[model samples]
Structures are given as C-alpha cells and as structure tokens.
Target: MALEWVVLSYAAGAEAVMLLLLTLPGLDGLRKGLVAVTKNTLKPLLSVVPFCLFLLMDIYWKYENRPSCGDEHACTPSEYIRHQKSVMKSQRNALLIAATLLLYWLLFSVTHLVIRQQQLSQRLEKLRNED
Candidate 1:
C-alpha cells in the first residue's frame, strides 16, 4: 500500500512536469516531439479507462458493504484489520481516479494542439494561394 502511494505520487509529479513542458514558451521544437509521443501513446493510454471503471466499482462495492468498525475497544482484531484494508482500498481507488484524470487531460491537450496546428497550416496555405 505504501509503495502504491509512492508510485502514484511520482506519476502525478511526472504528469505535472509534462504539462509544464508542453505549456512553456520557447520550446517549439520540443513541442513536436511531445505531441508525437502523446499521439503514439494515446491508444495505450486509453486502456486506463476500463481499469479506472473497475477501480471505481470496487470502491463503490466496498463502501456499500463495509462492515462497521464499532468502538476501538470493542473492535476485534479481524474487524480492525478489515477497517484498515477498506481505508487502503479507498486510497488506491482515489489514486487511480487521479491518474485516469491526468491521462485524459494529456489526451485532450495533444488533440487540441494537433487541431490548432492543422488549422494554422490550412490558413497559411490559403494565404499563399491568394498571393
């Protein structure tokens, strides 16, 4: 569980860095490379959607069927363990949702950039033709 948190933290940090790099000016050359990678990786990135749904369902199920933890003094050892497990499960599900959201953001950014580039090219072509 601890390791999952660490991995999720790193993933979130990397996504932030990628977004920063994409938005920074004076990096037009890097932009192309980033977009290319984004486009190529999109198909695989889509695989996250189903996994995210699964995580969400699992979280819902856990929430709906969770056993009562009762008073700390009255809680059995097994009940305490079950409560801890539920807490960990919730954390993992939240992390998965965050990662899925980040993936979608990256996809949207890449598609928007591609469309803008195409529009610019078309406008330039029309201008040249009018010359």
Candidate 2:
C-alpha cells in the first residue's frame, strides 16, 4: 500500500521534472535532445495511467469497506482516531492521484506541441532555401 503510493509519487515527480525541462527557456541547444528524450519517455510514462486507475479503485474499495466510526455506540475513542487518519490518508492520496494524471496530460500535450512546432519550422526553412 505504502509502496504503491511511493511509486506513484516518484512517477509524478519525474513527470513534473520532464515537463519543467520541456518548458524551461534558454535550452535551445538541448531542445532536440530533450524532445527525443521526451518522446521516448512518453510511452513508458503511460503506464502511470493504469496504475492510477488501480489506485483509484483501491481507494474506492477501501472507502466502501471502511468501518463507520460515527456510531457512538460502536466506535471507541481509538477507533475514531483511526477513522480520522484513514480519511485524511484517503484525501491526500486522492489529491496525489489527481495531480499525477494532470501532470501526465500536460507533459504529453507539451511534448506534442514542441514536436509539431519543430516540424513546421523545419519545413518553413526548407521552403525558404528552395526559393
């Protein structure tokens, strides 16, 4: 459980770093290499999608199966504390999940745009040289 979240965190962090590098200015010299790396990485990083879905379903299952701590007649003080902890954990995990998905989407879109711009610029340069 903890391991899953750790992996997800690493994936999210990597995506963020890649996205940052892609958008960062003054790396024109490295732009080609960055674009290549980003293109290659985009495929593997896609695994994060299914992994996120699994985590989401896990969250849902846990939520449905969780013990109700609100029953005053049933839940002890310790149980209530545990319930609060679980709820907090779920919220935090959900936020992380959302962030991870969003980062992936942004990274993919940015990489595509970068590649398309490069292609268009190259074509324009070729046409100019032909004149």
Candidate 3:
C-alpha cells in the first residue's frame, strides 16, 4: 500500500517534467513549426493530450487508494515505520525521475534549437543576398 504512493509520486514528478518540456520556449518553437503542417498530420501530434490525461488519471487513482496513517491522535509503531519508508522511497524515486527527464529534455531542446537556429541563419543570409 505504501509502495503505491511512492510510485504515484514518481509518476507525478515525471508528468510535471513532461509538461515543462512541452511548454518551454525551445520545445514550443519546434511544436509550433510542426503544428503549421496539415491538420491530418497534426492529428497524430494531438494524440499526446489524451495519453497524458490518461496517465494523470491513473496517478490520481493510485494516490487516492493509499491507506491513511491512522488518526492524528493514535498511530501504531508499524504504521509510523511504513509511512516514513513510503515517504522516503517516494522522494527518492521522484528525484531520480526528475533528473532523468531534465537530462533528456536538455538534450532534446538543444538539438532542436540548434537546428532551428541554423535554418533561421540561412534564411537571413538569403534575404541579405537578395537585397
């Protein structure tokens, strides 16, 4: 039961990272370019929305299912241990996932930004030559 919360926490952290990556300027620029394509192609890209929504639902369900750490007035020794362990494990997993996502997002954003920058430079050069 405790482990479930740990996993859910990790998942939430991961989702947050995903949201950040999707919205950040570098990524957003690439997404905008892709969106300019035909609606048929955009349909496939839009699929990510439903998929993310489903993931959020699953995370919430798992989090809600975890048992409460008894009442504030009376808590057993075993319950205390379990709760502590769960919180620790959840934090560890969430940090790990966040780090991994950050690394991947950095690499992805840099690559896309570089490509876009090159394209812009070429366009600017062409305009200057035309003048």
Candidate 4:
C-alpha cells in the first residue's frame, strides 16, 4: 500500500519538475531539447491517467466498505483513531491522484503548444527568406 503511493508520488514529482523546466523563461535554446523530452515522456505519462482512476475507484470502494467506528459517543478510542487515520489517508491519496492527473494534462498541453509554435515560427521564417 505504502509502496504504491510512494511510486505515484515519485512519478508526480518528476512530472512537476519537467513541467517547471518547460515553463521557465529564457530557455529558447533549451526549449527544443526539453520539448523533445516532454514529447517522449507524454506517452508514458498517459499511463498515469488510468492509474489515477484505478486508485480513485479503490479509494471509493474502501470508503464504501469501511467499518464505521459507530457514533462518536459509542466509539472506543482505538476505533476512533483508526477511523481518523483512514479518513486522513483517503484524503491524502485523493489529492495525490488529482495532482498526478493535472500535471499530465498540463504537460501534454504545454508540449503541444511548444511544438506548434516552433512549426509556425519556422514557416514564418521560411516565408521571410523567400521574400
């Protein structure tokens, strides 16, 4: 369980770093290489979307099947602690799932835009040279 989240966290962190690198200013020279890397990474990152959905369903299933600690007054200290921990873990996982998906989307969008901008710029330069 812990290992799964650890892996997801690492994936999310990598995507974030790559995203930050892509959006940084004054990197026209580096942008080409970064865009290439991002294009390659986009395929692998597509997997994250489905993975997040699966994890989200797992969280939902666990939530539905989770044992109640009963009403506040009736719950024992141990049961209350357990319930609180479960809720906290669920919330954390859900947030992580959302973040991973969002980063993937942003990465795809930004990479595509960069590629398109490069193509348009090249076309414009060619036209200027022809003139």
Candidate 5:
C-alpha cells in the first residue's frame, strides 16, 4: 500500500514537472511537436486510463486505511472552515497570477503588432516620397 502510494505520488510529480517544462519559453521551438504528441497520445492515455487508475487507487487507500480522527467529538468545526478558507485564498492567488501573466502576454502582442504596423507605414511613406 505504501509502495503504491509512493509510485502514484511520483507519477503525479513527474506529470507536474512535464507541465512546467511545457510552460517554459525556451522550449517553444519544440512545443508544437510536443503539443501534437500530447494531444494525439499522452492526453487521452493520461486523462482516461491513468486518471481512472489513480482515482481507484485513492479510493481504495482511503477506504481501506482511513485516517483516524483524534477525538472527533471534540474536533472544532471552525478548524475545517478555516482550512477551506485558506484553500480558497490560495486558489484565488493562483487565478490572479494566471490573469496577470495573460495580461502581460496580451500587452506584449499588441505592442509588437503596433510597432510592426508603424514600421510598414514608415517604409510606405518613404517610398512615396522617393517616387
């Protein structure tokens, strides 16, 4: 059981590393091919088969060896509520980070387009003046 948990954790960690690598700018040259491969092969395999396997594993582990609740009668509901609040806060922070990155990328693309258009216009004007 411990070995299975360890292996599953490792697989999840590896998948996370792969995701991070996909996000890096330096890997853009190969990203299209990678995306193709992921879309054609890995995506379906991981999303369907591995996900179901992992879900089953988790359910089995949780059911077979449930964590003991220390003095459940005395357990504070506030603590669970606070934990949920913290999780929500963290999710919000992640969303903010994603939004900021998307905004930066959008601004960069717009600026690049404007610069290219200006250069083209300048070239056209110069040609007209020469003629």
Candidate 6:
C-alpha cells in the first residue's frame, strides 16, 4: 500500500509539472512534441479509464464495509484510534481516486483539443494553397 501511494504521488506530481510546462512561454517545441505523441498513440492511454473504474470499486467496497465507531463519545482509546485510522485510510483512497480521474480527464481533453486545432490549421492551409 505504501508503495502504491508512492507511485501514485510521483505520477501525480509529474503530471502537474507537465501541465505547468505546457502553459509556459517559449516551450512550443515541447508542446508540439507532446501533441504529436498524444495524437499518434492516445488509445493506449484510455486503459487508465478501466483502472480508474477499479479504483472506484475499491472505494465503494471500503465504504460499504467501513468500521463503525458505535457511540463516538463512548469509544475506548483503542477503538477510537482504530476508527480514526480506518477513516483516514478511506479518505485517502477516495481522494487519490478522484485525483486520478481528474488528471485523466484533463489529459484527454487537452489532447483532443490539440488534435482538433491541428486539423483546422491543416484545412486552412489547404484552402489558402488552392486560392
């Protein structure tokens, strides 16, 4: 579980950095490279969709089987500790799943927009050439 969290954290950080880089000025080369790669091989990235669905299922299972801290005020010290840990773990898992989905959506939308823009540009160039 720790390893999974570490991997996810690194991936999320890398994605955030890439997004920031894409918006910076004087990075047209980097942007074009990303667009080109994405255009050529976007189908592979869609695999993440199923993976995210799995994560969502895991979250649902955890929620359905959550440990109840019956009578919060009356919980013994150990019972309270256990409940707190369980709640924290569940929250972390839910947040990670949400973040992963959001990242996938952002990447997919950006790739689609980039491809559309390229197509429109090509059409405009062809029209200009015919004139």
Q: Pick the candidate with the highest lDDT.
A: 2
User: Where does the lowest 10-residue lDDT sum fall in candidate 2?
Assistant: 68-77
Ranking by lDDT: 2, 4, 6, 1, 3, 5
Local distance difference test, candidate 4: 0.91
lDDT against the true structure, each candidate: 0.68, 0.95, 0.53, 0.91, 0.50, 0.69
> lDDT tens string, model 5, 75-110?
467765765565564455344334433433443344
User: lDDT tens digits, residues 46-69, model 4?
Assistant: 888888888999999999998876
lDDT of 1 by residue, 21-73 (tens): 66677887777787667666556656656655666676788788877766644
**TM-score to native of every candidate shown:** 0.64, 0.96, 0.39, 0.94, 0.43, 0.74
Q: Which scores better on TM-score, 3 or 6?
A: 6
Better of 1 and 3 by lDDT: 1
lDDT tens digits, residue span 1-131, model 3 = 44644544554454445445444666545654542332233334344345444544554565677567766556688977886786665556445444544544554454456457667988999999999
Q: What stretches of model 1 exceed 4 Å from their correct place? A: 1-17, 70-73, 76-85, 88-92, 125-130
Q: What would the per-residue lDDT of candidate 6 be over residues 1-131, giving only the tens digit for each residue?
A: 56755666665555555555555668776878877765454466556557657766776887788767666547778988987887788788778867866776676677777668778988999999999
Model 3, position 20, has a per-residue lDDT of 57
Which portions of model 2 miss their true places by more than 4 Å? Answer: none
Better of 3 and 4 by TM-score: 4
Backbone clashes per model, in order?
0, 0, 0, 0, 0, 0
Ranking by TM-score: 2, 4, 6, 1, 5, 3
Model 2 error, position 117 (Å) = 0.4
What's the true lDDT of residue 41 in model 6? 46
